[model samples]
Target: MTTSEIWQPPSEFAEQCRELYGLTCPPRWGTPRRPEYPSLGPKAWKVMERLGFPPMPWQRYVLDVALEIDPATGLFAYREVGLSVSRQQGKTQQILGVQVHRAMAWARQNIVYAAQTRGMARQRWEDEFLATLDDSSLAGKYRARKSNGHEAIIWRKTRSKMGITANTEKAGHGPPLDLGVIDEAFAHEDDRLEQAFSPAMLTRPMGQLWWASAGGTDKSAWLNKKRAAGREIVERLWAEGVHPRIAYFEWFAPDDLPRDDPATWRMCLPALGFTVTEATIRAELEKLDPGEFDRAYLNRTRKSTPPQDPNVPVAAWQGLADPVSQAGPELAFAVEVSQDRAWSSIALAAAREDGRVHLELVDRRPGTDWVIPAVVRLRELWDPVAVAVAASGSPSASLIDGLIAAGVTAPEDKERPRRGDLVVMRSGDLVEACGQMADAINQGTAVHRDQAELTAAVSGARTRPSGDAWTLDRRRSLADVGPFYAVTLARWALVSRAEAGRDDYDPLDSVY
Candidate 1:
C-alpha cells in the first residue's frame, strides 16, 4: 500500500479509537507510512516487548512510518527522523527500544545517544537506560562500561556498542555511526550537533539520525529551525504527492485551541489516556505558569517580541518629558553599563525648585575607557551630593574600583552615607530604585529632557524578580537599558542622600 492507504482506519473505528485511547494516531502532521515497503518497526516492537516495555499505540504509529525500509535501496527509507511531541509521552521508552533493536539486530553497529551536555547524557544513560536494560529479559546479553567520559553499553553477542555523548560539534569525531539520537533537542541553541553527526553517518548505508523534543521558547534557535523545516515539508507533501527523505512527526495543539479543554489535550497529547490523565494535566495546569504549560504540555512554541516595560507605559513616560528641563542645584549622579559591557551611561538627578525631580542622561558612549574620566569631570563640575553604582549583580559593578581610585570616595558605612560618597547600591537598593522611578513618573513628580537614549531605554526595559520586589533585567531586555537604569539610580541616590541629611557642601560654590 502507498503512504495514503497505510493508516486510514474506518471513520467509525477512528472515532472510537480517539474516544478510548485519546491517541492522535498518524500524528497531527507527519510522513505517512508505506506498508508495501518492508519495515523494522514490528521487530523493534517485539524487542520492546521482550524488554518488558511495549510500545504504546502512538509510539507504534511513529515507528511504523519512521522505520520503513526503502524497497528500491533495501535500506531505511529516511536518512533522518524528527519527532516533536508533548512531554511525558513515553518518548524515552520509544527511543530506548529503537537503540536496543538497532544494536541487537545489526552486528557491530555503532549507536549513540546525546543530550545537551555530557553530564546530562551520562546521567540519563546511568539512571534510566542502563537501569531499564539491567532489569529486562536480555540483561545478561549486554556489558555496561561505567567509566566516566567513556560510558557505553556493549551487546556481548553482536559486539555492537551504544555510547553516550554531549550535543557538541566535536561529539562525532571518533567513529562512524549507524544510529545517532539527539534527545531533548530543544535545549540546543544551534546546529552544532547536526554538523557533528551528519558527516559521521555519511558513508553508512543504513545510518539514521533522530531529533526529538517537546516545544521550546524562541531562543531555541536550532530546534525551531528544524520544526519550521518539518512543517514546510509536510505542507509540500500534501501539495506534490511525493515523500521526502526526512520523516517528520509533530503532535501539537493549534494556537487557537483552548488550553484547559480536555478535547484540546486529546488532540495533541497522544498518550493522554494511556500514560497520563485529564486530572493530572489539570493539576499541572494549576501549578505551571501559562506560557510554560503551553510549551511543555500542549507542545506550543513560546513566541517572543521586543521588550516593553509594563511598569512605565510609553504614553505615560512621554507625558512626563520636558525638552528643555534643567537640573536643580542639589544633584546626584549614577553610572550604568550595558549587559554586554559594550556601552556605558551616566545620568544625573536633582531636586527642582517646584518640588519635582529632574532626570537627565548626561553621557552615553561606547566602552569603559571613557567612563572614569567623564565621571571625574562631572564630579568636579557639579559637586553632586552623591554618586551611585550598583554594588553587585550588574555589569556596572565592575566600575566601582576605578571610580574609587579616581577620587570618588566610597562610604565607609553604606547605612550612613556622607555627601560626596560613592553609594554602592545593593540588590535591595536597586529594587527600590526601580520602584521609586516608576512611582515618580506615574505620580507626575519627575521630569526628563526627553533624550533619545533615555526614551529608547524606557521603551524596552524589562524586569526580573528580586526577593519580594523587582529590578531591571538588562540582560534579557530588547534594547540597552543602561541609560534608564542610571537615571533611576541617580534619583534614588538624591532622595536617599537627602534623608541622611549629610550634604555639608554648598551647591553655589560648584562650577556648573
Candidate 2:
C-alpha cells in the first residue's frame, strides 16, 4: 500500500500515555483529540498473515492489544497477552508498531524501551523500532531524528518526543514515560523490579504503558513472590474487591505432561501454533540426548539427594482416615528442615489403624524462619503432646527452645524419646526412610496439603550423574528437603499417644 493509501494521519496527533493506553483522560500533554484508526480487525490480520503468522490467538491478541487505548487504566490489558510467546514471535513487531503509532499520532509523548540489561534493551529499537519506521507511515513524522542505537529514537520536533532505556533498580528518569516495553521478562527477577520503574512511567498526566516477558525460575524470591502476589492481586481485583485492571498470559508445561514418555514434548508447548511442525518436532527430539532434554525442556526437577546416597528410592506413603468421624487424642507433629537454605519440609503423620501411619498433611517450605512458625502453631494445639522437631542447628534449636518457653510446646523438662529426636542419621537410613514414607503415601498412608508442590518435587526428582544423585532443585521445588524433613515427621508421629488426647489435630496448613 502506498503512503497515501494507508489510513489518514491526523493533522497533529500526540503519543501521550493516555491515548496510547486507550484511557479516558484530559489531554494535559501531547496532541489533544483522540486519534482514530480502523479497529484492529481485518487490516491488521491481512498484514500479519503476509508477515508469516498463522491465525493463532497471539495474532488476534496482538490486534486486540493494539486496538485497546486506555492510559488511565488497563495497561495490563496490553502487557498480559503480548509478552507470553517465543522469541521470534510477532510481539516485537507489535511493540515497535505501537511506539511508532504513538509518536506519529501523539505530540510531546514519551516512549521508552526497557530490558533487564542495557545492551539487550537497546536491540528492540535497532531491530524492530527502526525497521517498522522504514516500512510505515511513521517514517516522515519527524524532519530530524537519529537512530540512537538500542538506547532510543529521538525526534527533533519541539512538540513530541520518543526514547528508550533499560529499567534498573534505579528509575529510568529524565522524561515522563507514556509507553514502555520490557523484553524477555521471564528473565527479570520478581522482587518489585518493575514497581521501581513503573511509577516513573505514570508521571505523565496520560499515565503509562507496560508489556513484559513471561516469568522465569527465580522461585524463592522474584517470580515466586509475584506468583503469590499475582494470585492475591487477581482475587482482589477480579474476585473480591476492585483494584487496577490486570492481565496474565502463561504458556508452560501442562499438568499432565507424562513423565513416563520423556519425549512427550508436544504436550507442553501448545502455543506453538503454526511454528511447530513434524520436521521441527523430529529435529528437536533428535538433537536432545534424552536426559538433558527431559530436565531442560520437560522441566523435570530433581530431588536434593543426601550426600551419601541420593537415589534413595522412597517407598510410597498413604493417608488413611479413621472410619469413625471423631476419634483419638490431640496429635503431636514433627517437622524436618533441609540443608538447602531454600527448602525445608514439615510432615504431620497422624494415628490410624493398628501401628500403620497416615500423613494428614505435609509442607516443603523454604528456610528455618519459615519452618518455626508452623511448628509453633502445631505445638500449641497439641499442647501436652511433645513436639518432635528436627534439631538441625542453632536456628532450629532456638525455635524449639522458643516454642517451649512461649507455651507452644510441653516444657523441656517433660521431653521424652518418641516426642522428639534429631532422628540422627544412619548412612543407609535416609533412602530407606524415604522409601518407607513414599510407600506410606502411595498406599494412601501419607497425604500432602498442596500436592502441586509436593508432587512436583517427587515426580521431578530423578537420577543425576554417577556417584551423585538427584537432589531437589531448591530453586525450582519447595520439597528440596534433603531427607530430614519428610522422614522426621513420620518418626515423630509413630510414637505419639494413641490412647491419650489426640482429637484436636487441625489439618489446616497441610491441605488446600
Collision count for each candidate, in order = 0, 56
How many residue-pair clashes does candidate 1 contain? 0
Q: Estimate each model's TM-score.
A: 0.58, 0.47
Top model by TM-score, which number? 1
Question: Residues 1-512, candidate 1, lDDT per residue (tens digit)?
Answer: 11221233235434534453344554666666665888888898898888787888888767877899999999999999999999998899989999999999999999989987899989999999999998999899999999988899999999999999887779877789999999998899999989999999999999999989999988899999999899788767766868888999888776546678898898788888888999999999999988899999988887664546676566778999898889977889999999889889999998877778899999888788999899999888988889999997789899999999999988788777766789889888888999988887887888998776788788778888887878889987767899899999999888878644544643322211
RMSD of each: 17.3, 14.4
Model 2 per-residue lDDT tens digits across residues 45-129: 5444433443344444445434545655523233322334333334565555555555544577777766666666656556766
Worst window of 10 by summed lDDT in candidate 2 = 24-33
Colliding pairs, model 1 = none
* CA-lDDT, candidates in order: 0.84, 0.44
